[model samples]
Target: MFTNEQVDRFHKDGFLVVPHFLSQATSQRLLKISHEYLEQIDLSNHPLTRFTTSDKDHLGDEYFLNSSDNISFFFEPDAFADVDGHHKLVKPKERAINKFGHGLHLCDANFAAVTSGNADVSEIAKGLGFQRPRALQSMVLCKQPEIGGAVPPHQDSVFLYTDPLSAIGFWIPLEDATRENGCLSFAPGSHHDHPVTKRFVRRFDKETGEQLDGTEFISLENREQIEKGFAKEENQKWVSVECKAGDLVLIHGSVLHKSEVNSSNKSRFAYAFHLIEDTAVYDKLNWLQSSVKSILY
Candidate 1:
């Protein structure tokens, strides 16, 4: 459970950085397992799934799906103390662009759509003031590259459209995330009120042919212009979440947030888990007319 002050901050700011959520030992152990899993799946260089055009360009024909699927990295010493699945749990990454420029080097996806982590997320959501709980959605995000792999600024809500206003996220940096390596920057309290926009188009890397279209990315310069276009009240309140390994940031469903481009020689990795409302039966508010009218009248 979170303190009143902590929960208050989440409502007011649309985000909160919880420090040291994972113990050092757990962090090290999880890191090791991630590596082992990569090897077992033969994802040595982390050749993940990329989106090609259509059926004609199906990314994986030679790469067969590991029949022994649903493997767990959370076995025993697994970092996540809890479990559940359903929404999405992805390990996303990006490398570099080849000579063709279109030959987008490394953009891949691995181990996704998980139902675990509900217990963990439910508790967090209640602390933030959600009365009823339901299993919402969760996912992992990774973008580690030198150049030509900048993720455009965007919001998750626009992408994974779901229910109830309780959707919130937990973003963890698997590695030390910094401005140099593209940590996330957010427009504070944008969630409380903001204009909804069209889902932006996605791009694809040349080499992998993985489509980069996501509610999570957009062009940098375009982002700047969009931010500037906001009212002065909105611009002054923007906040960038730059965390080190082991830190976690909680974000609201409607928050306006995005990451910077990785210009560093090293790699960048981060994981995000979100919950809508967990298991709580909201019979009255299940419908807009009933829920709203019931409350208002």
Candidate 2:
């Protein structure tokens, strides 16, 4: 549970960092499970989907889109090397993946233990004024050594949209996150100024009204208004947030945040999940959808 001062800080700054939120044993257990999942990946029949937010053209494919209720793997853009006319993995498959995500908490028992129905998480959610918090998507982001990609500045609500925008991100570092290893950075209090003006939605065929294969980002505002909003954000200063293993960083859904590319020899691995108020209406057109019953503690 958080103190009154900590809650005030979160409301004022749009983010809060709690040192050693998880025990070393719990952190290591999660990391071990992540490694086990990675080691079992069979890339022979994989489509080799590279996860990137920078490229709009390469956003989501069938493998990525259909991962809402199932565990799935995604590769880093630089994880492959062109061999002859075919693309080959530059490293072992375990080290080459960028992340495996979207449904770990619902499908995996170990992850579900820490994520769903946890006393600590439930307490935190209640303290944050969540009456019925629903755990939605979960992922293990692997910022691989030397090839980790930079995440573009964006808000979480753009992807996991709700009627009143109640999405919150819980990010826990599994290893030491440093400036050299692609730690998260944030524009302090940007959530107050930056409104949710864009949404990442699932496209559909106009003639048949059937859902399309990929996703796209659509503007809630006109072009001129969106341009002006971007201009306003260009002047804001960003502060790097570095943390040790087991540290918890709570991110506001509307906050502008990003991470740089990892240029170091060390890897930065982290577990993250999103929660939304069940009272809010979840948009049907959002890219992620789940049939599994959401965990509510």
Candidate 3:
């Protein structure tokens, strides 16, 4: 549970880091289970969906779009090597995966134990004034050594939008996070300054009323003005958030945050999930739609 001072800091700065949120043993257990899951994946016929934060390279294949209720793997953009004009995984599949996600908390008992119906997490959600917080998504981000791609600065509300825009991210590192290993960096208080002016939505064909193949970031504001605003935000200062294993970082929905590419020899693995207020209207056009039962805590 968060203290009054911690909650105040989170509201003011748009993020808060709580040290030792989980025991080191618990963190390691999750990491071990994740690795086991990765080892079981047979990537021979995989669609090779590469996850990227860029709108141009955004993934919207069936594997990704349908992963809302199933655990699916995504490779890092740089995890492939060009060989004879074909792409080949540079490392083993277990090491090449950037993440496996979207439904771990709902489908995996190990992840569910830590994410849903947990006293501490529920208390923290209540402390943040969430009347009906739903854990909608969960993932284990594997920032593999040297190949982990950089995540561009963006707002979480864009990806997980609601009418009132109530989305919060819970990030916990299973290994030590540092500047060299792609630790997250945030523009403090950016949530207050940068409103949710765009949404990453699934496109649909007007005639057929069927979902399109890919995704797009539709502008909530004037297209020209939103582009200008985003250009200006590129120069904003960001503070790196470095922490040890088991530390929890709460990120505000609209905060501008990003991480650099992993250039270190060591890998950085982390577990993360997003929570949204069930009272708010979750946009139907949002790329992710839950197929499982609602997990309210």
Candidate 4:
């Protein structure tokens, strides 16, 4: 639970970095599990889903479906074998995984406890004034050495859409995270101004129950118009949030945040999960929708 001062800071800054949320022993254990999964993942017939904005191409059906409940991997844009071409070539599966996620909490008991038990992320949410927070997704980000990806400035509400835009992420570092190793940087109070612009959604052919192969975006406002507004506010300064093992960073849904590419020799590992208002209407069009029974902690 956070004190009034801490809560005040979060509302003002759009983010809060709480140190030592997990014990050193716990951090080590989770780090070990992260590596074990990396080794265990079979790439034999893996659907290589590399997420990149450089090409501006749409993601495939394999990425959308596999993203829901599996611990699938997505490669960084820089991990490509050839970086010059429009169709950037990917490196071998083992070497290219920028992140592997979506179901770490549901599938792993240790991770479940972090959200629901001793770590009690639920209590923290309630303390910060969430009415009915529900755990939605979990992932381990491998800001891999040298080729770590650069995440563009964006808001979480765009990807995890709810009617009133209630979503927050609990990002924890398993190792040291610094500006050099792609630690998060956030625009102080951007959430208060730019709540949402566009959303990633699932479009269905009403006549058939079959799922579509392509994903679509639903505009919350005229994209260019909203982007212009944000551009005007771009002068707002962002603060780099460097953290250590066991530290937790709470991020508001509408906050503008991004991370740089890891150019260091060592890897930076972090585990992240998000929660949304359970009672709110998670739109039918949300691409990442799941049953309340399945997502709620």
Model 3 lDDT tens row, 1-297:
578999999999999998999998999999899989899998778898988877776888889988987899999878788989988887889888999998999889888877885788888998999989999899999999999888889989989999888999999999999999999999998887777788898998869888777788887866566455453577678999999999999999999999999999999999999999999998679999986655565
Cα RMSD, each candidate? 13.7, 1.8, 2.0, 3.2
Counting clashing residue pairs in each candidate, in order, gives 28, 0, 0, 0
lDDT of 1: 0.46
Per-residue C-alpha lDDT of model 1 across residues 1-297, encoded as one tens digit per residue: 457888888888878888876555644554454444444543354233342222233232212121012221111011112336532223222132110101001111221211233344445665766665433323234454554244444455544343333456777676777888878887887766553343222344648866433212323334455554454433545566778776778877777777666778665655555445543333311111011110100
lDDT value for model 4: 0.78
- lDDT by residue for model 2 (1-297), tens: 578888899988889998989999999999999999999998789988988787456567888988988889999989988999988888888888899888999889888877875788888898899978999999999999999899888899999999888999999999999999999999999988777788898898869889887888887856466456453678778999999999999999999999999999998999999999989999778999888758575
Better of 2 and 4 by lDDT: 2
| Cα lDDT of model 4 by residue, 70-109, tens digit | 5777776666655575565466555567888787776788
Question: Candidate 2 deviates by what RMSD?
Answer: 1.8
TM-score against truth, every candidate: 0.57, 0.95, 0.94, 0.88
Clashing pairs in model 3?
Answer: none
What are the Cα lDDT values of the candidates?
0.46, 0.88, 0.88, 0.78
TM-score of 4: 0.88
Please list all clashing residue pairs in model 2, or write none if there are none: none
User: How many angstroms is residue 64 displaced in model 3 relative to the true structure, after the best TM-score fit?
Assistant: 0.5
Give every collision pair in model 4: none
Which has the higher TM-score value, candidate number 2 or candidate number 4? Answer: 2
